[model samples]
Target: MTPSQRTLLWVYAAIIAMWPIRHLAIWFIFRKLDILTPDSPRLTMDHPPLVTAIIPAKDEEGTLAECLASVCAQAYPNLEIIVVDDRSTDRTGQIAREFATADPRIEVLTIEHLPPGWTGKTHAAQQAADRARGDWFWFLDADTRHSPENLEIVMEYARDRGAALTSLLPEMRCETFWENVVQPLAGIVLMQSYPLFRVNNDRSSLAFANGQYILIKRSAYEAAGGHHAVRDRFVEDIRLAARVKALGLPIRVAIAREIGSTRMYASLDQLVRGWSRILYDALGRNPWRLLGRLLDPLIFSQTGHVAFVVALFLLARGHTSPFAFWLLGLSVVHHIFTYTVLARVYHMSVPRSRYVAWFPVANLVMDVILIRAIKMCLTGRVTWRGTAYGPTVTSSTRPVTKPVSPN
Candidate 1:
């Protein structure tokens, strides 16, 4: 090869080498929080803040009633539940109205018209927050089923820590094929990218929150301009977290393994639709930047290399040597160490985590999905919550009606 070509090859090698090096730094430096069942703290408040539970539902009738029932059953002393029916063509509004009638603490609003630059969910949530009478606002998805003790536990944690914003990384219940394959990758990427240590210290640029369940102090939410500030953001949770940190608020996040759970997507199509909605914005549109994220699985998943070495030994036959065997042994050791560490930190069962052993193929599949997601995002053809969203999209400015009780 010519001198220039060789130099270019070396540059490419360095680029590839940089990814794993960065991941190694993250794994070593990121502090992990204790993940076992936590003990309840003694009450320190004379009167706990009134917690407002906000649900933004769009064609989510199936899960709306159960979600409402769970919130009503919370052990927290002071609570208000608000469900925003974001132009649902289904029975969402009717279900919410029925719940509100039986319990006056519940209020339902119907958003007949959506405004410009506002993502549907956030728009509905913003309206709900505007009408909320609670000291704290908890934004929850329609699909998540909460335990009765959910609010009490989270509120205590929030008060003790003086958190401006807090979110629970619910225990994921994966029953489908797509869920098993894709869900593990989410935790892997999260562990690899946003190490818990740096996030707690509030020093790094890596900011994140699962939007499924985020609780923010009312004052903090309003001060940060609330959901209005992130109306245009596809990945609103991270954007909101970044805004919270910018405001110098004390932000706390924890894994709610036993507190709550969700079945995110039941089918592969729904899974892709859910992820694709935010992929381009999540990684940004720059190809170079996206390539950086594409390499994370490799850093986290070394088991694929072991399989390669085994295949190489079989193919080499007579050509196999002591050095080859030594290399294979090292790869096995690396694979075992990485997966074991992951299992402990994330509170994952080792049996289920053995799935990490096939991460190479999974990584490749994730890359394709990401690429497709990015393409959809760039083309302005992203659809979410049964609504087609694009750069040219606009909402009707017509005023909406306040919901009336079913009775």
Candidate 2:
């Protein structure tokens, strides 16, 4: 091998060294996180603060009923449910109304028109908050199904931590084969992208929140300008968390399997589109960062698989590098450790955790999501739940300003 090629091999080997460190460190940090479970000590209050569960759903007829039912069944004494049907061209409104009729605590709001500058969800949430009579607002997605004790447990956690904003990273309920193989891996990537270690730290400026299950103090939410502050953000959850953090209030996220569960995407098509949108926003719509994310699998965690194969080929051609073998060894051990951790902490079923062995295929899926996200960013528009949004707030370079109203 040429001297230049030998030096390049060393550079590559150094990069490979990072794979195990990054994965294992993240796992350890995850292990240290205090997760809220059914058995966790519940917070008792002389008078519990009212919690308003606001669900913003568009064409979510299939899932809205279950979500509303879960909210209605909350163990917390003072709780109310508000369902927002955001221009759904389906039975979403009807289902919500049925639930409202059955339960006095439940209310439905039908949004017939979306203002020009606001995204459908933020607008719906903003309107709901305006009429809500609660000290706290729980913004939940239609896909989420909570345990009876879920709200109580989260309220306990939030109170104990003194957090102004608390979001749970739910136990993902993955049923399909593809979902099982890809979902956990997607979460791992997302965790890396968001870096919960700093997010949970009050001193750190970095912050993130899961929109699927978020609990925010009404005062804090309003003080940070509520969803209206992050009206145009595709990743409003994260932006809102930043807003709260900027106000010197702590925002925290925890792995709360017993608190609730959510099936984010029902099929492969939904998975692709949903994940692409999230990845696009996570990268901050920066083309360079998107490119780096696209190349992550090629050079980082999964690089060892392809590098090992090439190493074998080079050996057959009487060309060999010790670093290649070193990296191959590292990748193999890393996968084994990761799969073990998955079985131990992530997936309840050992067989399901074995899906981590399919990392190579999952990496391909990640690449595809990255590509789709890049395309969306370049087009300057993202279609989510049948709504297309462009730059629509002052946060971006081009601002689209309009009043928040119902027509």
Candidate closest to the true structure, highest TM-score: 2
Per-residue lDDT over 231-344 for candidate 2, one digit per residue giving the tens place of the 0 to 100 score? 877788998999999999998888775668888887888888989888788778877788887776677656666666776676677655665555456556645654555454
Q: Write the per-residue lDDT of candidate 1 for residues 46-99, one digit (tens) a residue.
A: 688788999999999888887788788877778888899999999999899888
* Candidate 2 accuracy as TM-score: 0.87
Candidate 1 is scored at a TM of 0.83
Runs in model 2 lying further than 4 Å from the true structure = 1-9, 311-352, 392-407
Tell me how far the alpha carbon of residue 3 in candidate 1 is from the true structure, in angstroms, after superposition. Answer: 19
Candidate 1 segments exceeding 4 Å error: 1-31, 34-38, 42-46, 202-206, 298-310, 313-318, 321-334, 341-354, 357-361, 397-399
